[model samples]
Target: MGNISGAIVMTNLIQVGIDIGGTKMLTIAYQHSKIQARSQISTGKDFTAADAQTEIERFIHTLAAPPDGIGIAIPGLVDRAGVVIACDVLPNLVGWQPAIAFSSICPVKVVNDAQAALMKVVSELKPQTVAAVVMVGTGIGAAIYANGMVLSGANGWAGELGSIPIEGKTLDAQASGAAILAQLGIDANQSNALVGANDITALQSIERAGTSLGMGLAILINLLNPETIVLAGGTLQWRGYLAAAMQSTQRYSLPDLWASCRLEVSQHGGDLVGLGAASIAI
Candidate 1:
Protein backbone atom coordinates (compact mmCIF):
# COMPACT_ATOMS: atom_id res chain seq x y z
CA MET A 1 0.00 0.00 0.00
CA GLY A 2 1.12 3.57 -0.72
CA ASN A 3 1.34 6.28 1.90
CA ILE A 4 -1.95 7.44 3.30
CA SER A 5 -2.88 11.08 3.07
CA GLY A 6 -2.96 13.22 6.22
CA ALA A 7 -6.75 13.43 6.12
CA ILE A 8 -6.94 9.80 7.24
CA VAL A 9 -4.72 10.47 10.27
CA MET A 10 -7.46 11.94 12.48
CA THR A 11 -9.86 9.04 12.26
CA ASN A 12 -10.06 5.27 12.17
CA LEU A 13 -11.82 4.52 8.92
CA ILE A 14 -11.92 1.26 7.00
CA GLN A 15 -12.30 1.18 3.25
CA VAL A 16 -13.22 -1.74 1.01
CA GLY A 17 -12.35 -2.08 -2.63
CA ILE A 18 -13.62 -4.68 -5.07
CA ASP A 19 -12.22 -5.41 -8.50
CA ILE A 20 -14.59 -7.37 -10.71
CA GLY A 21 -12.92 -9.02 -13.68
CA GLY A 22 -14.22 -11.48 -16.24
CA THR A 23 -12.31 -14.46 -14.77
CA LYS A 24 -12.02 -13.44 -11.12
CA MET A 25 -13.08 -10.98 -8.46
CA LEU A 26 -10.83 -9.54 -5.78
CA THR A 27 -11.84 -7.68 -2.67
CA ILE A 28 -9.48 -5.90 -0.33
CA ALA A 29 -10.03 -4.36 3.08
CA TYR A 30 -7.90 -1.37 3.95
CA GLN A 31 -7.42 0.56 7.19
CA HIS A 32 -5.22 3.65 7.22
CA SER A 33 -4.04 2.72 3.70
CA LYS A 34 -2.73 -0.67 4.82
CA ILE A 35 -4.27 -3.92 3.71
CA GLN A 36 -6.12 -5.61 6.55
CA ALA A 37 -7.57 -8.51 4.64
CA ARG A 38 -8.12 -9.72 1.11
CA SER A 39 -10.14 -12.34 -0.72
CA GLN A 40 -10.45 -13.72 -4.23
CA ILE A 41 -13.14 -15.73 -6.00
CA SER A 42 -13.45 -17.21 -9.46
CA THR A 43 -15.85 -15.45 -11.83
CA GLY A 44 -16.78 -18.57 -13.69
CA LYS A 45 -19.69 -19.28 -16.03
CA ASP A 46 -21.98 -19.47 -12.99
CA PHE A 47 -20.97 -16.09 -11.69
CA THR A 48 -23.61 -13.38 -11.43
CA ALA A 49 -23.97 -9.83 -10.10
CA ALA A 50 -25.43 -11.19 -6.89
CA ASP A 51 -22.42 -13.42 -6.51
CA ALA A 52 -20.14 -10.41 -6.76
CA GLN A 53 -22.08 -8.56 -4.09
CA THR A 54 -22.04 -11.60 -1.84
CA GLU A 55 -18.30 -12.05 -2.27
CA ILE A 56 -17.73 -8.42 -1.35
CA GLU A 57 -19.86 -8.74 1.74
CA ARG A 58 -18.05 -11.95 2.66
CA PHE A 59 -14.65 -10.24 2.35
CA ILE A 60 -15.86 -7.40 4.52
CA HIS A 61 -16.74 -9.91 7.22
CA THR A 62 -13.07 -10.91 7.39
CA LEU A 63 -11.94 -7.38 8.15
CA ALA A 64 -11.11 -6.40 11.72
CA ALA A 65 -13.39 -3.39 11.54
CA PRO A 66 -16.55 -2.50 9.67
CA PRO A 67 -16.07 -0.60 6.42
CA ASP A 68 -17.04 3.07 6.29
CA GLY A 69 -16.91 3.30 2.50
CA ILE A 70 -16.60 1.04 -0.52
CA GLY A 71 -15.48 1.30 -4.11
CA ILE A 72 -15.96 -1.15 -6.96
CA ALA A 73 -14.02 -1.44 -10.18
CA ILE A 74 -16.14 -3.08 -12.84
CA PRO A 75 -15.23 -4.18 -16.34
CA GLY A 76 -17.09 -2.35 -19.13
CA LEU A 77 -18.60 1.06 -19.77
CA VAL A 78 -20.34 2.46 -16.72
CA ASP A 79 -22.90 5.17 -17.24
CA ARG A 80 -23.30 8.25 -15.05
CA ALA A 81 -26.20 6.53 -13.32
CA GLY A 82 -23.84 3.83 -12.03
CA VAL A 83 -25.31 1.25 -14.39
CA VAL A 84 -22.96 -1.02 -16.28
CA ILE A 85 -23.78 -0.22 -19.87
CA ALA A 86 -21.68 -2.62 -21.90
CA CYS A 87 -19.47 -5.43 -20.70
CA ASP A 88 -18.74 -7.92 -23.45
CA VAL A 89 -16.24 -9.66 -21.20
CA LEU A 90 -18.82 -10.13 -18.45
CA PRO A 91 -22.13 -10.22 -20.24
CA ASN A 92 -24.06 -10.98 -17.06
CA LEU A 93 -23.10 -7.62 -15.56
CA VAL A 94 -24.63 -5.50 -18.28
CA GLY A 95 -27.22 -3.01 -16.97
CA TRP A 96 -26.48 -4.01 -13.40
CA GLN A 97 -26.64 -1.30 -10.71
CA PRO A 98 -23.53 -2.09 -8.72
CA ALA A 99 -23.71 1.00 -6.53
CA ILE A 100 -27.34 0.55 -5.70
CA ALA A 101 -26.85 -3.12 -4.96
CA PHE A 102 -24.16 -2.22 -2.45
CA SER A 103 -25.75 0.97 -1.17
CA SER A 104 -27.12 -0.62 1.97
CA ILE A 105 -23.66 -1.94 2.77
CA CYS A 106 -21.94 1.48 2.82
CA PRO A 107 -21.21 4.58 0.81
CA VAL A 108 -20.19 3.23 -2.59
CA LYS A 109 -18.60 4.49 -5.75
CA VAL A 110 -18.26 2.48 -8.97
CA VAL A 111 -15.86 3.02 -11.81
CA ASN A 112 -14.93 1.38 -15.07
CA ASP A 113 -12.04 -1.04 -14.58
CA ALA A 114 -9.73 0.62 -17.10
CA GLN A 115 -10.54 4.04 -15.72
CA ALA A 116 -9.81 2.76 -12.24
CA ALA A 117 -6.45 1.49 -13.44
CA LEU A 118 -5.73 4.88 -14.91
CA MET A 119 -6.56 6.47 -11.55
CA LYS A 120 -4.00 4.23 -9.88
CA VAL A 121 -1.35 5.35 -12.35
CA VAL A 122 -2.28 8.99 -11.89
CA SER A 123 -1.98 8.75 -8.13
CA GLU A 124 1.72 7.98 -8.50
CA LEU A 125 2.49 10.71 -10.96
CA LYS A 126 3.22 14.40 -10.43
CA PRO A 127 0.03 16.37 -10.05
CA GLN A 128 -1.38 17.86 -13.27
CA THR A 129 0.57 15.49 -15.53
CA VAL A 130 -1.37 14.09 -18.46
CA ALA A 131 -1.25 10.33 -18.66
CA ALA A 132 -3.00 7.30 -20.14
CA VAL A 133 -3.29 3.63 -19.23
CA VAL A 134 -3.74 0.83 -21.77
CA MET A 135 -4.43 -2.68 -20.53
CA VAL A 136 -4.17 -5.65 -22.90
CA GLY A 137 -5.53 -8.67 -21.14
CA THR A 138 -8.38 -10.96 -22.17
CA GLY A 139 -9.18 -7.81 -24.13
CA ILE A 140 -7.71 -4.36 -24.71
CA GLY A 141 -9.03 -1.34 -22.83
CA ALA A 142 -7.69 2.17 -22.18
CA ALA A 143 -8.38 5.27 -20.07
CA ILE A 144 -7.00 8.78 -20.32
CA TYR A 145 -6.24 11.19 -17.48
CA ALA A 146 -5.79 14.78 -18.51
CA ASN A 147 -5.31 17.90 -16.40
CA GLY A 148 -6.31 16.60 -12.97
CA MET A 149 -9.05 14.05 -13.70
CA VAL A 150 -10.00 11.07 -15.85
CA LEU A 151 -11.59 12.04 -19.13
CA SER A 152 -14.80 10.05 -19.07
CA GLY A 153 -16.61 11.51 -22.04
CA ALA A 154 -20.28 11.68 -22.91
CA ASN A 155 -22.06 8.30 -22.64
CA GLY A 156 -19.02 6.99 -20.71
CA TRP A 157 -17.70 5.40 -23.92
CA ALA A 158 -14.65 7.63 -24.24
CA GLY A 159 -11.99 5.03 -23.68
CA GLU A 160 -13.33 1.93 -25.36
CA LEU A 161 -10.10 1.39 -27.26
CA GLY A 162 -10.75 -2.31 -27.64
CA SER A 163 -13.72 -1.56 -29.80
CA ILE A 164 -11.78 0.80 -32.07
CA PRO A 165 -12.08 -0.21 -35.70
CA ILE A 166 -8.91 -1.34 -37.39
CA GLU A 167 -8.77 -2.78 -40.86
CA GLY A 168 -12.49 -3.51 -40.78
CA LYS A 169 -12.16 -5.38 -37.48
CA THR A 170 -12.13 -4.26 -33.86
CA LEU A 171 -8.82 -3.86 -32.05
CA ASP A 172 -9.94 -6.54 -29.59
CA ALA A 173 -10.31 -8.99 -32.47
CA GLN A 174 -6.67 -8.52 -33.39
CA ALA A 175 -4.82 -8.00 -30.10
CA SER A 176 -6.61 -9.61 -27.16
CA GLY A 177 -5.35 -12.77 -25.46
CA ALA A 178 -8.25 -14.73 -26.92
CA ALA A 179 -7.50 -13.40 -30.37
CA ILE A 180 -3.81 -14.24 -30.13
CA LEU A 181 -4.55 -17.72 -28.85
CA ALA A 182 -7.04 -18.30 -31.61
CA GLN A 183 -4.56 -17.11 -34.21
CA LEU A 184 -1.99 -19.53 -32.83
CA GLY A 185 -4.42 -22.46 -32.56
CA ILE A 186 -4.04 -22.53 -28.81
CA ASP A 187 -7.01 -23.38 -26.65
CA ALA A 188 -8.24 -20.60 -24.38
CA ASN A 189 -7.89 -22.81 -21.32
CA GLN A 190 -4.25 -23.55 -22.20
CA SER A 191 -3.12 -19.96 -22.51
CA ASN A 192 -1.24 -19.76 -19.21
CA ALA A 193 0.58 -23.04 -19.71
CA LEU A 194 1.47 -22.20 -23.30
CA VAL A 195 2.66 -18.72 -22.34
CA GLY A 196 5.02 -20.26 -19.81
CA ALA A 197 6.52 -22.65 -22.35
CA ASN A 198 9.16 -21.52 -24.84
CA ASP A 199 6.88 -22.11 -27.78
CA ILE A 200 7.97 -20.35 -30.98
CA THR A 201 4.45 -20.08 -32.44
CA ALA A 202 3.03 -18.61 -29.24
CA LEU A 203 5.84 -16.07 -29.01
CA GLN A 204 5.28 -15.02 -32.60
CA SER A 205 1.59 -14.61 -32.01
CA ILE A 206 2.25 -12.50 -28.92
CA GLU A 207 4.60 -10.30 -30.90
CA ARG A 208 1.94 -9.84 -33.56
CA ALA A 209 -0.59 -8.94 -30.92
CA GLY A 210 1.86 -6.50 -29.40
CA THR A 211 2.28 -4.82 -32.76
CA SER A 212 -1.47 -4.44 -33.10
CA LEU A 213 -1.74 -3.07 -29.58
CA GLY A 214 1.03 -0.59 -30.26
CA MET A 215 -0.74 0.68 -33.34
CA GLY A 216 -3.86 1.30 -31.34
CA LEU A 217 -1.87 3.11 -28.63
CA ALA A 218 -0.11 5.23 -31.19
CA ILE A 219 -3.47 6.62 -32.20
CA LEU A 220 -4.26 7.42 -28.59
CA ILE A 221 -0.91 9.16 -28.12
CA ASN A 222 -1.39 11.30 -31.22
CA LEU A 223 -4.78 12.39 -30.01
CA LEU A 224 -4.22 12.80 -26.27
CA ASN A 225 -0.56 13.91 -26.23
CA PRO A 226 -0.12 12.49 -22.75
CA GLU A 227 3.11 12.76 -20.84
CA THR A 228 3.21 9.06 -20.05
CA ILE A 229 1.52 5.81 -21.07
CA VAL A 230 1.34 2.89 -18.65
CA LEU A 231 0.84 -0.56 -20.12
CA ALA A 232 -0.70 -3.27 -17.97
CA GLY A 233 -2.54 -6.64 -18.16
CA GLY A 234 -1.58 -10.31 -18.53
CA THR A 235 -0.87 -10.27 -22.24
CA LEU A 236 2.23 -8.12 -21.70
CA GLN A 237 3.97 -10.89 -19.75
CA TRP A 238 5.36 -12.62 -22.85
CA ARG A 239 9.08 -12.14 -23.50
CA GLY A 240 9.98 -9.65 -26.23
CA TYR A 241 6.37 -8.47 -26.38
CA LEU A 242 6.94 -5.14 -24.64
CA ALA A 243 9.87 -4.35 -26.92
CA ALA A 244 7.74 -5.18 -29.94
CA ALA A 245 4.95 -2.97 -28.64
CA MET A 246 7.29 -0.04 -28.02
CA GLN A 247 8.86 -0.37 -31.44
CA SER A 248 5.50 -0.40 -33.18
CA THR A 249 4.27 2.50 -31.05
CA GLN A 250 7.25 4.51 -32.21
CA ARG A 251 6.70 3.51 -35.82
CA TYR A 252 3.08 4.63 -35.92
CA SER A 253 3.06 7.61 -33.54
CA LEU A 254 4.14 11.10 -34.49
CA PRO A 255 7.84 11.44 -33.80
CA ASP A 256 7.49 14.32 -31.35
CA LEU A 257 4.71 12.68 -29.38
CA TRP A 258 6.48 9.35 -29.25
CA ALA A 259 9.72 10.99 -28.14
CA SER A 260 8.14 13.10 -25.43
CA CYS A 261 5.87 10.43 -23.97
CA ARG A 262 7.29 7.81 -21.67
CA LEU A 263 5.86 4.31 -22.13
CA GLU A 264 6.24 1.76 -19.32
CA VAL A 265 4.50 -1.19 -17.71
CA SER A 266 2.32 -0.82 -14.61
CA GLN A 267 4.08 -0.72 -11.24
CA HIS A 268 1.05 -1.68 -9.14
CA GLY A 269 0.93 -5.24 -10.54
CA GLY A 270 -2.24 -7.14 -9.55
CA ASP A 271 -3.39 -4.68 -6.92
CA LEU A 272 -3.92 -1.86 -9.41
CA VAL A 273 -7.66 -1.99 -9.77
CA GLY A 274 -8.30 -2.56 -6.07
CA LEU A 275 -6.05 0.29 -5.11
CA GLY A 276 -7.64 2.62 -7.61
CA ALA A 277 -11.11 1.75 -6.44
CA ALA A 278 -10.05 2.30 -2.87
CA SER A 279 -8.84 5.76 -3.79
CA ILE A 280 -12.43 6.76 -4.41
CA ALA A 281 -13.32 5.82 -0.86
CA ILE A 282 -10.24 7.45 0.61
Candidate 2:
Protein backbone atom coordinates (compact mmCIF):
# COMPACT_ATOMS: atom_id res chain seq x y z
CA MET A 1 0.00 0.00 0.00
CA GLY A 2 1.07 3.56 -0.62
CA ASN A 3 1.96 5.82 2.30
CA ILE A 4 -1.05 7.75 3.67
CA SER A 5 0.83 11.04 3.39
CA GLY A 6 0.85 10.62 -0.37
CA ALA A 7 -2.93 10.93 -0.54
CA ILE A 8 -3.21 14.58 0.47
CA VAL A 9 -1.06 17.68 0.15
CA MET A 10 -1.80 21.36 0.64
CA THR A 11 1.11 23.06 -1.07
CA ASN A 12 2.96 25.19 1.53
CA LEU A 13 0.26 24.95 4.18
CA ILE A 14 1.39 23.39 7.48
CA GLN A 15 -1.18 21.26 9.24
CA VAL A 16 -1.37 19.56 12.63
CA GLY A 17 -2.94 16.25 13.60
CA ILE A 18 -3.70 15.04 17.08
CA ASP A 19 -4.67 11.57 18.29
CA ILE A 20 -5.93 11.51 21.86
CA GLY A 21 -6.42 8.28 23.79
CA GLY A 22 -7.04 7.32 27.40
CA THR A 23 -3.37 7.20 28.29
CA LYS A 24 -1.53 9.33 25.77
CA MET A 25 -1.79 12.14 23.24
CA LEU A 26 0.18 12.26 19.95
CA THR A 27 0.65 15.35 17.83
CA ILE A 28 2.26 15.83 14.44
CA ALA A 29 2.83 18.68 12.04
CA TYR A 30 3.38 18.41 8.32
CA GLN A 31 3.77 20.65 5.29
CA HIS A 32 3.77 19.47 1.68
CA SER A 33 3.84 15.80 2.75
CA LYS A 34 6.94 16.19 4.91
CA ILE A 35 6.82 16.01 8.69
CA GLN A 36 7.84 19.24 10.37
CA ALA A 37 7.46 18.13 14.00
CA ARG A 38 5.96 15.44 16.21
CA SER A 39 5.42 14.87 19.92
CA GLN A 40 3.75 12.50 22.36
CA ILE A 41 2.71 13.12 25.95
CA SER A 42 1.10 11.23 28.77
CA THR A 43 -2.46 12.15 29.72
CA GLY A 44 -1.92 12.23 33.45
CA LYS A 45 -4.41 11.15 36.13
CA ASP A 46 -6.25 14.46 36.19
CA PHE A 47 -7.16 14.26 32.51
CA THR A 48 -9.95 16.53 31.37
CA ALA A 49 -10.85 18.67 28.37
CA ALA A 50 -8.98 21.57 29.90
CA ASP A 51 -5.95 19.41 30.53
CA ALA A 52 -5.97 18.18 26.95
CA GLN A 53 -6.23 21.72 25.64
CA THR A 54 -3.30 22.75 27.80
CA GLU A 55 -1.12 19.94 26.52
CA ILE A 56 -2.09 20.59 22.94
CA GLU A 57 -1.27 24.25 23.23
CA ARG A 58 2.09 23.42 24.80
CA PHE A 59 2.92 20.92 22.06
CA ILE A 60 2.06 23.37 19.30
CA HIS A 61 4.33 25.93 20.90
CA THR A 62 7.23 23.54 20.34
CA LEU A 63 6.78 23.77 16.61
CA ALA A 64 8.79 26.40 14.74
CA ALA A 65 5.69 27.63 12.91
CA PRO A 66 1.98 27.67 13.60
CA PRO A 67 -0.19 25.21 11.71
CA ASP A 68 -2.75 26.36 9.15
CA GLY A 69 -5.30 23.78 10.23
CA ILE A 70 -5.73 21.11 12.88
CA GLY A 71 -7.54 17.80 13.00
CA ILE A 72 -8.15 15.80 16.15
CA ALA A 73 -8.95 12.08 16.49
CA ILE A 74 -10.60 11.36 19.83
CA PRO A 75 -11.58 8.05 21.39
CA GLY A 76 -15.28 8.68 22.00
CA LEU A 77 -18.55 9.77 20.46
CA VAL A 78 -18.20 13.19 18.84
CA ASP A 79 -20.88 15.32 17.26
CA ARG A 80 -20.82 17.22 13.98
CA ALA A 81 -20.05 20.38 15.91
CA GLY A 82 -16.90 18.73 17.35
CA VAL A 83 -18.29 18.34 20.84
CA VAL A 84 -17.52 15.14 22.71
CA ILE A 85 -20.81 13.60 23.75
CA ALA A 86 -19.49 10.63 25.68
CA CYS A 87 -16.24 8.83 26.40
CA ASP A 88 -15.39 5.78 28.44
CA VAL A 89 -11.83 6.72 29.34
CA LEU A 90 -12.02 10.49 29.26
CA PRO A 91 -15.31 11.05 31.00
CA ASN A 92 -14.52 14.65 31.86
CA LEU A 93 -14.48 15.49 28.16
CA VAL A 94 -18.17 14.70 27.72
CA GLY A 95 -20.08 17.73 26.39
CA TRP A 96 -16.83 19.60 25.92
CA GLN A 97 -15.83 21.15 22.59
CA PRO A 98 -12.09 20.90 22.56
CA ALA A 99 -12.04 21.92 18.95
CA ILE A 100 -13.62 25.23 19.85
CA ALA A 101 -10.84 25.86 22.30
CA PHE A 102 -8.33 25.40 19.50
CA SER A 103 -10.22 27.61 17.08
CA SER A 104 -7.87 30.50 17.84
CA ILE A 105 -4.96 28.41 16.58
CA CYS A 106 -6.45 27.13 13.35
CA PRO A 107 -9.47 25.61 11.68
CA VAL A 108 -10.24 22.45 13.62
CA LYS A 109 -12.08 19.22 12.98
CA VAL A 110 -12.70 16.47 15.51
CA VAL A 111 -13.89 12.93 14.83
CA ASN A 112 -14.12 9.51 16.45
CA ASP A 113 -10.74 7.78 16.49
CA ALA A 114 -12.01 4.64 14.78
CA GLN A 115 -13.81 6.69 12.16
CA ALA A 116 -10.62 8.57 11.55
CA ALA A 117 -8.81 5.28 11.04
CA LEU A 118 -11.51 4.20 8.62
CA MET A 119 -11.02 7.40 6.62
CA LYS A 120 -7.36 6.46 6.22
CA VAL A 121 -8.33 2.94 5.10
CA VAL A 122 -10.92 4.22 2.66
CA SER A 123 -8.38 6.54 1.11
CA GLU A 124 -6.31 3.51 0.10
CA LEU A 125 -9.10 1.44 -1.40
CA LYS A 126 -10.45 1.35 -4.95
CA PRO A 127 -13.31 3.80 -5.31
CA GLN A 128 -16.69 2.55 -4.12
CA THR A 129 -15.29 -0.63 -2.52
CA VAL A 130 -17.08 -1.41 0.73
CA ALA A 131 -14.82 -1.72 3.76
CA ALA A 132 -14.92 -1.79 7.53
CA VAL A 133 -12.33 -1.26 10.23
CA VAL A 134 -12.56 -2.85 13.68
CA MET A 135 -10.18 -1.40 16.25
CA VAL A 136 -9.36 -3.43 19.41
CA GLY A 137 -7.48 -1.27 21.83
CA THR A 138 -8.56 -0.30 25.33
CA GLY A 139 -11.95 -1.05 23.80
CA ILE A 140 -13.58 -2.04 20.52
CA GLY A 141 -14.85 0.41 17.90
CA ALA A 142 -15.69 0.06 14.23
CA ALA A 143 -16.38 2.19 11.15
CA ILE A 144 -17.77 1.38 7.72
CA TYR A 145 -17.07 2.96 4.35
CA ALA A 146 -19.24 2.54 1.26
CA ASN A 147 -19.68 4.48 -1.97
CA GLY A 148 -16.64 6.58 -1.08
CA MET A 149 -18.10 7.94 2.16
CA VAL A 150 -18.13 7.04 5.83
CA LEU A 151 -21.39 5.81 7.34
CA SER A 152 -21.71 8.24 10.26
CA GLY A 153 -25.35 7.23 10.72
CA ALA A 154 -27.93 9.29 12.53
CA ASN A 155 -26.63 10.91 15.74
CA GLY A 156 -23.01 10.19 14.70
CA TRP A 157 -22.91 7.13 16.93
CA ALA A 158 -22.88 4.51 14.21
CA GLY A 159 -19.63 2.70 14.99
CA GLU A 160 -19.81 2.37 18.74
CA LEU A 161 -19.86 -1.42 18.37
CA GLY A 162 -18.06 -1.99 21.64
CA SER A 163 -21.26 -1.19 23.47
CA ILE A 164 -23.28 -3.82 21.61
CA PRO A 165 -24.64 -6.58 23.79
CA ILE A 166 -23.19 -10.04 23.31
CA GLU A 167 -24.27 -13.00 25.41
CA GLY A 168 -25.70 -10.62 28.02
CA LYS A 169 -22.46 -8.61 28.13
CA THR A 170 -21.15 -5.65 26.12
CA LEU A 171 -18.55 -6.50 23.47
CA ASP A 172 -16.00 -4.32 25.25
CA ALA A 173 -16.64 -6.09 28.54
CA GLN A 174 -15.67 -9.39 26.94
CA ALA A 175 -13.15 -8.45 24.25
CA SER A 176 -11.28 -5.22 24.98
CA GLY A 177 -7.67 -5.00 26.11
CA ALA A 178 -8.86 -4.01 29.56
CA ALA A 179 -11.16 -7.02 29.60
CA ILE A 180 -8.36 -9.38 28.58
CA LEU A 181 -6.02 -7.99 31.23
CA ALA A 182 -8.71 -8.26 33.87
CA GLN A 183 -9.44 -11.84 32.91
CA LEU A 184 -5.75 -12.69 33.20
CA GLY A 185 -5.49 -10.87 36.56
CA ILE A 186 -2.47 -9.00 35.29
CA ASP A 187 -1.53 -5.35 35.50
CA ALA A 188 -2.00 -3.45 32.23
CA ASN A 189 1.68 -2.49 32.27
CA GLN A 190 2.74 -6.11 32.53
CA SER A 191 0.70 -7.42 29.61
CA ASN A 192 3.65 -7.47 27.21
CA ALA A 193 5.92 -9.30 29.63
CA LEU A 194 3.31 -11.92 30.54
CA VAL A 195 2.27 -12.49 26.93
CA GLY A 196 5.88 -12.70 25.78
CA ALA A 197 6.52 -15.38 28.42
CA ASN A 198 3.67 -17.47 26.92
CA ASP A 199 1.74 -17.46 30.17
CA ILE A 200 -1.16 -19.86 29.85
CA THR A 201 -3.59 -17.53 31.57
CA ALA A 202 -2.67 -14.67 29.26
CA LEU A 203 -3.04 -16.85 26.19
CA GLN A 204 -6.43 -18.07 27.32
CA SER A 205 -7.60 -14.53 27.92
CA ILE A 206 -6.48 -13.50 24.43
CA GLU A 207 -8.29 -16.45 22.88
CA ARG A 208 -11.47 -15.50 24.67
CA ALA A 209 -11.11 -11.94 23.48
CA GLY A 210 -10.57 -13.16 19.93
CA THR A 211 -13.69 -15.30 20.09
CA SER A 212 -15.80 -12.41 21.37
CA LEU A 213 -14.36 -10.12 18.70
CA GLY A 214 -15.14 -12.67 16.02
CA MET A 215 -18.76 -12.81 17.07
CA GLY A 216 -18.96 -9.04 16.68
CA LEU A 217 -17.34 -9.24 13.24
CA ALA A 218 -19.88 -11.87 12.22
CA ILE A 219 -22.68 -9.47 13.00
CA LEU A 220 -21.05 -6.80 10.84
CA ILE A 221 -20.53 -9.24 8.00
CA ASN A 222 -24.16 -10.33 8.07
CA LEU A 223 -25.34 -6.74 8.02
CA LEU A 224 -22.93 -4.77 5.84
CA ASN A 225 -21.49 -7.54 3.68
CA PRO A 226 -18.33 -5.54 3.34
CA GLU A 227 -15.64 -6.48 0.84
CA THR A 228 -12.78 -6.05 3.34
CA ILE A 229 -12.43 -5.92 7.11
CA VAL A 230 -9.32 -4.59 8.78
CA LEU A 231 -8.44 -5.52 12.36
CA ALA A 232 -6.28 -3.11 14.24
CA GLY A 233 -5.07 -1.67 17.59
CA GLY A 234 -2.80 -2.62 20.47
CA THR A 235 -4.65 -5.65 21.80
CA LEU A 236 -4.27 -7.64 18.57
CA GLN A 237 -0.51 -7.94 18.98
CA TRP A 238 -0.51 -11.72 19.27
CA ARG A 239 -0.59 -13.55 15.92
CA GLY A 240 -1.97 -16.73 17.47
CA TYR A 241 -4.79 -14.76 19.06
CA LEU A 242 -5.63 -13.14 15.70
CA ALA A 243 -5.72 -16.58 14.07
CA ALA A 244 -8.26 -17.61 16.67
CA ALA A 245 -10.19 -14.44 15.94
CA MET A 246 -10.32 -15.33 12.23
CA GLN A 247 -11.47 -18.82 13.12
CA SER A 248 -14.34 -17.46 15.14
CA THR A 249 -15.28 -15.10 12.33
CA GLN A 250 -15.31 -17.98 9.84
CA ARG A 251 -17.43 -20.06 12.15
CA TYR A 252 -20.03 -17.42 12.99
CA SER A 253 -20.24 -15.57 9.68
CA LEU A 254 -22.36 -16.88 6.81
CA PRO A 255 -20.25 -18.92 4.42
CA ASP A 256 -21.02 -16.77 1.40
CA LEU A 257 -20.33 -13.48 3.19
CA TRP A 258 -17.13 -14.75 4.80
CA ALA A 259 -15.91 -16.07 1.46
CA SER A 260 -16.43 -12.70 -0.20
CA CYS A 261 -14.58 -10.64 2.41
CA ARG A 262 -10.89 -10.26 3.12
CA LEU A 263 -9.47 -9.79 6.62
CA GLU A 264 -6.29 -7.81 7.29
CA VAL A 265 -4.36 -6.40 10.23
CA SER A 266 -3.49 -2.72 10.03
CA GLN A 267 0.05 -2.11 8.81
CA HIS A 268 0.18 1.57 9.78
CA GLY A 269 0.79 0.83 13.47
CA GLY A 270 0.82 3.89 15.80
CA ASP A 271 0.86 6.31 12.90
CA LEU A 272 -2.63 5.26 11.78
CA VAL A 273 -4.59 7.78 13.82
CA GLY A 274 -2.20 10.65 13.17
CA LEU A 275 -2.29 10.07 9.44
CA GLY A 276 -6.06 9.74 9.47
CA ALA A 277 -6.50 12.99 11.37
CA ALA A 278 -4.14 14.74 8.96
CA SER A 279 -6.16 13.46 6.05
CA ILE A 280 -9.19 15.21 7.48
CA ALA A 281 -7.29 18.46 8.01
CA ILE A 282 -5.91 18.63 4.50
| Alpha-carbon deviation at 206 in model 1, angstroms | 1.1
Q: Model 2, range 1-282, lDDT digits (tens) per residue?
A: 212332344457877888887667888886777667888887633578887788779878988888787889888899889999888867887888866787787889998999878877876787667889888887789988876667888877788889999999999999888788778777666877877888777888888889989999999998999999988787787646687789999999999999999999988887788777877875
On lDDT, the candidate that comes out on top is: 2
lDDT of 1: 0.78
Tell me how many residue pairs clash in candidate 1.
Answer: 0
In model 2, what is the error at residue 58, expressed in angstroms? 1.6
lDDT per model, in order?
0.78, 0.81
Report the C-alpha displacement of residue 183, candidate 1, in angstroms: 2.8
Query: Where does candidate 2 stray beyond 4 Å?
Result: 1-11, 44-46
